[model samples]
Target chain A: MAELLVYLAATLVGVAFLLALYRFFKGPSSADRVVAFDVLTIVSVTAIALVALAEGRGIYLDVALIYALLSFLGVIVVARYLERGL
Target chain B: MDIVGGLLLVGGAAFLLFGGLGLVRMPDVFNRIQAGTKATTLGTLLGLAGIACLQPDWALKLFLIGLFILFTNPISSQVLARAAHRSGARKSALTAVDRLEEDHGA
Candidate 1:
């Protein structure tokens, strides 16, 4: 059951990633692309968590943490740049 | 416990899928921000919770990730929205309010 669920979740997340990628490419404005990128990163973090579970490794969780932090900072920086020409 | 965790994981993934759909289907930048931010935040948190359940010993780290996400996601989204608005991202004709515009006196 766990195995089946893991595969199901992975498939769903993969589809979500594709959708975000589409928006990232097709977005009419930079802000829309940024929003799509944000969603992409969040979905990636969830995928990382799923990977950790599938592999039974605790170390991947730490990687997920750092990825989340960096992505948050990246988004903030980009947003600031957009707002104030920084 | 495994079944419960798996269920949660699937549920979270489902939410993420919807968020992605909304990101693609929303008519404008602000609406995309709303859909992407809110749904992904909840989905990520729930995914972390599911992982925590699956690995009881790693609950602490999972909780930390979840907490960080809860705080930062909204802040980032708000900043993005403000930036978008300030940079003149076009709004859909369906939008009926302009409170931020009024506040900015622009």
Candidate 2:
């Protein structure tokens, strides 16, 4: 049952990634694209967690942690640049 | 335990799906930011919790990740919203107010 749910969760996350990608491509402005990018990174983190669960490995969790940190920093830097605050 | 963990995983993924939907469907930058930030934050946290439940030994690391996301997601979103406003990202035509503009004098 847990294995089945892992697959289901992966499918959902994949759909979420595609939706975010559409927004990234079609967004009317830079801010909208940034928002889409932010969502994409978050979804990816969830995907990584799901992968770790499926693989039954603790190491993948470290990758999720680092990815989340870097993504947050990247978004912040881009936002600051947009506002000319950087 | 497996059933409970699976349910949480599915629930979290569903929230993420909604967040993505909101990102695409929202009419303007601020609305998209609102949807993307709040929903993803919750979804990521819940998904991490589900993982922790599924793998007991990894619980500490998962909790750390969740805590980090909870702290960073809102801060990043707030910065993005302020930047969008300052950079003159167009607001939706149906937007009823301009509180940020009034307050920031931008």
Which candidate should be chosen as best, given lDDT against the real structure?
Answer: 1
Alpha-carbon shift of residue B102 in model 1 (angstroms): 2.8
Q: Which residue segments of model 1 deviate by more than 4 Å? A: none
How good is model 1 by TM-score?
A: 0.97
- lDDT tens readout by residue for model 1, B53-83: 8899999999999899999999999999989
Query: Which residue window of length 10 is worst by lDDT in model 1 chain B?
Result: B97-106
- Give the per-residue lDDT of model 2 (tens digit) for B1-106: 8777777888888889999999988889999999898889898888887877788898899999999999999999999999999999998899999987888776
* Candidate 2 Cα errors over 4 Å, as ranges: none
Q: Write the per-residue lDDT of candidate 1 for residues A9-76, one digit (tens) a residue.
A: 89999999999999999977899989999999999999998888889999999999999999999999
Q: In model 1 chain A, which range of ten residues has the least summed lDDT?
A: A1-10
User: Each model's RMSD to truth, in Å?
Assistant: 1.0, 1.1
